[model samples]
Target chain A: MTINASKDLYAAVPDEQGRFGPYGGKFVSETLMAALAELEVVYSNLSTDKHFQQELDHDLQHYVGRPSPLYEAKRWSDSIGGARIYLKREDLNHTGAHKVNNTVGQALLAKHMGKKRVIAETGAGQHGVATATIAARLGLDCVVFMGETDIQRQALNVYRMKLLGAEVVSVTSGSRTLKDAMNEAMRDWVTNVDNTFYIIGTVAGPHPYPMLVRDFQCVIGREARAQSLAQTGRLPDALVACVGGGSNAIGLFHPFLHDESVAMYGVEAGGHGISTNQHAAPLTAGTPGVLHGNRTYLMQDSDGQIMDTHSISAGLDYPGVGPEHSWLKDIGRVNYVVANDDEALRAFHKLTKIEGIMPALETSHALAYAETLAATMTPEQTIIVNLSGRGDKDILTVAEIDGIVV
Target chain B: MSRIAGRFQQLAAQRRTALIPYIVAGDPSQDATVPLMHRMVESGADIIELGVPFSDPMSEGPVIQQAHERALANGMCLSRVLELVQEFRKSDDTTPLLLMGYANPVMYMGYKAFADAASAAGLDALITVDIPPEEVDDINAQLQRVDMDNIFLVAPTTPEERISRIAAGASGFIYYVSLKGVTGAGHLDMEEVTQRLAAIRRHSQLPLAVGFGIKDADSARAVAAVADGVVVGSALVNAMAQTLADGGNSGQAIEAVASLLGEIRQGIDSAAS
Candidate 1:
């Protein structure tokens, strides 16, 4: 599937009937149907409002420390002997990940709604931590629901949330992972419909969340565009990022979707390999279905039961990608590919040694593609990668795999 | 021997409290659920709230969520749970059985089909956690057509207008979530819940069941003192978890919890008397 880069694509969204390429539409109970209709109207008005945009811009500049750097990885680029490699450094952002950017914007929206409490769910716990941080900053009562397994594995994050004055509830249902946490979060949203705001952690869930989270996260691409232009005097030949629920990738890709000259690639983590059960490469291997909220590509068995996904990075071990990504994949604005565990691990070590940066195990998928992109093109062409997050939290898992103490 | 409302009315006229125990049918396994429910009825449970397994139950705590997940994993369909209710009806038709679950499964099964199935299965009523009375359509209409009650929730924050609207739709009873948060959160405030109940009763004459944080016998008895019924879930589900941790299956766990409910019933009975 290939999209005509010259075609006006933004109009394709919210089409004649407010549908997103058969992926997104309002499919909620009629009780809150009017509320959603009102929300849609408010969202359209607010999205285009100059004051709202100005307030958001002000926060992004001073509060979030935006326009993050674009670093040229000369050593890594030379090692691959191909394209000139540069990284859009989102890892250097406040809260140590790109998640905080979305959280800050959504929390403000919650405040605008007069919502008193914020509820969220997390998988790798990065989003949970970011949501908690913002909720604490905003002085809103925060409740985070995480899978019990994730709570145990990401113990430091759980403690961080507690320190931030958020109540952490461990979800022990379903597969005891991200999906279960999402289900539990939806339940909380339904139960506390009046005063609570569900701060969805990713570019998933029903309409508005995916679109709204993407809009908030567009800072990544907006920054990368200016930085690349200033540093290289032109746009890069290609853009690359890892997709786990696609928040980071969408953050970087939303601005560049119409760039005719630049190609885009999203690498999915294929644990062991896609042939085996231990992989999270949903775009490469899944069928279209509904879960969480909207219809999207999901890794499921023949019976439509979602499969248990496995990855060295807990963040990438999701059975589905964001619905917009599914639409984008179908339309082919971005090429979706897989990077298996071994290649990602090798890239992780390579980045640490050659670039003085240890990429998150999830981000290693993008780094793995860096080698491929660099090797395939001449040094004249440049590839800008979104370094979505730091690897500090993933050190233990990486070290355990390497049989090392540090 | 009698209609569920008649039985509840009789108990209400006698100024006695009703013992309601909840069990997630097909939890742990299907083979154990029906027998355990019967055992619960025999062990002094006056009314039973049978949990129909759902994929997502956000209002539930970890314990109840786990039980529901386990049941759903074991292939517990809404039809299968209704069949379990039918099996229970073969022996004891007097005990009121309310089917409690999230709305998706019931909606997917088609409201008319679900109501017909529930009626055929001899189930008394429904308490869909996510379905508000204002949104009641196919399911409520079908249930009413079949003469089965549709229970609605009156939360602590329910506005008076909404309360009256919910009262109009409510038939068998009203489930008033005692806490502002989800189930199994913390302690409940009796004063707040009693006030809410009074507000609800001013609009309608339906029985009210207070739940969400009724943990022990004292809490249940305290709620029963004012509310028409008490729905206990999280604590019983926690007991199931505890029993499983102690190497007992759900059948044995439910029986163990049923004995605890028996003791709680005694407390309620003595307190009411």
Candidate 2:
């Protein structure tokens, strides 16, 4: 199905109120409104400023290793015997994940805004490490809020954040997970709004944040778009990416939103299965409500209380998704599918043995869906899967799941 | 006039600062809340802010956050909170009652349905922590239809222009968050509260109620001196939590909360005297 070409989807989104068709809006406490407004003004001005663009590009090139390669998985595609599959290797970035692409941009904005302190909330710790890396480089004081549960699971990244000079605060409230950490981070920001710059990790949060983070992460799609045309002489037939808070997915999807011919698929974590309550696939199994400062598809109970989600990958365990994805799903601009834990694990093992690449468990969800999609298409069709992160941080999780002492 | 506006006007005529005491509806237990509400009104609470327990209370400090946890653990929900309001109105319908909470539960109930149900249950006003003036138009319209007041918070960080915008749409009164942090945070900053309230007064005729950091009689008196009302939340919640933590029964918890409200009332009255 082709979207109308005359609509100009990019030019009109998150309209003045930061709403993406009633999904995204500023749903924060009154304390953060001015800060969000200040951020919106600075980002709007600096986003188009030539010097700011040049500086951000410089950092993306040298510091974050931009233009992460899009490699064609010839063997894997041949084995599928359907479509040619290419991998957008965001796993090869400086932090071994696509998270750095946004952190660098936001850290620069913090410096330009003259803020001296930076704070963030992380679940799997990839975003935390990335923010810590940038804060260390900029000599800014950094504090990262991670749930006590995630701190235990992602110990290596937690230590890495500490080594990078970020004080890791362990949040122990409300299921001890990403959402709780975010609440703590918000409280901290409200308390110290004058000197603190909150670096939201994904395409979520209040206004300007969803838009700002998307702009920064769009580097992935921009690079993949150019590389696809240069190498294959056409845009890929399909794009696939895992959706947690949907930063990487939106990054890869936004640039192609205006490309009517390109199909997009966002894979959500179907923990046990979407049929069961034990899943984080909000777009698949949940209703629309407000959480974490935006109105989006959320895994909430009948009482509107957020449900505890169970995803094998800590990164994909959030009960809510980015509001833009909610909008896209409603408008039929994107197809949202789910990959259960077993399916994702099988894809993880398959990619490790067949492609000689270890993909993060979170990324494996997208790969699982891509594999299924590629098998249904003709060989002339091409698919690009966003390899959002490397699997090194998740080795221990896989080991524990297999009952192996790693 | 709405019950909230009437109560504020009554307090103003008497040259008294309204004492608004807040408690989660099902904090100690579901049965304990109605009695606590009656006790608070009898103890000179001009308004009662009953908290609706949500899974995530992002704008709350540790004390109130734990209270929400306890309330939810006891099976509290939006429907249950409304039921409690109905029960509170059984005998004492004069005291203004407000439901303070995050927006998700009410949104889940549907805006029109929630507004109608709340108005039917005798709720005077609402303070959704996350819904500022920008995103409040839809809910505000529903509230206006029901002749209910929609209160907005004017925080320490709220700019002058936004204050004007918020005050223009706000009904009942303006909630001046006395500090930049969440509920239950310390450091009242009396000077900042006094200044922000002054700035807010320039925009609208809404009465100003100062909350956050007002933990005791002295702090309540300090805020009452500069604002039309004093909202004490965490201190009362902490008293109830401590009572329950010490193995006290529901009656003891109610007594503990009412005692704190009585002292805050005394403080406010002392300031007026």
What DockQ does each candidate score versus the true complex, computed on alpha carbons? 0.15, 0.92
Off by over 4 Å in 2: none
RMSD of each: 5.7, 1.2
Tens digit per residue, CA lDDT, model 1, A1-406:
5577664675467453335686754433223333444455666778898887888788777877886789999999998889999998888877778888889888878877889899998988889989998898889999999988888777878899999999999886777788888878877775566788888888887667788888888889988888888899999999999998999999998898888788999999889898887899889998776566555788866434567888877788888888888888988788999899889999989999999998888899999987897799998999999999888887777777889986
Q: Compose the digit string of candidate 1's lDDT tens values, residues B10-123.
A: 888888867777778787788888787888778777788999876656567767877887887888878888889999889987788888876656755678888888899898
Worst 10 residues of 1 chain B by lDDT: B130-139
Worst 10 residues of 2 chain B by lDDT: B1-10
Candidate 2, residues A18-53, lDDT tens digits: the string is 988879999999999999999999999999999999
Colliding residue pairs in candidate 1: A187-B58
Interface RMSD of each: 5.4, 0.6
lDDT of 2 at A106: 98
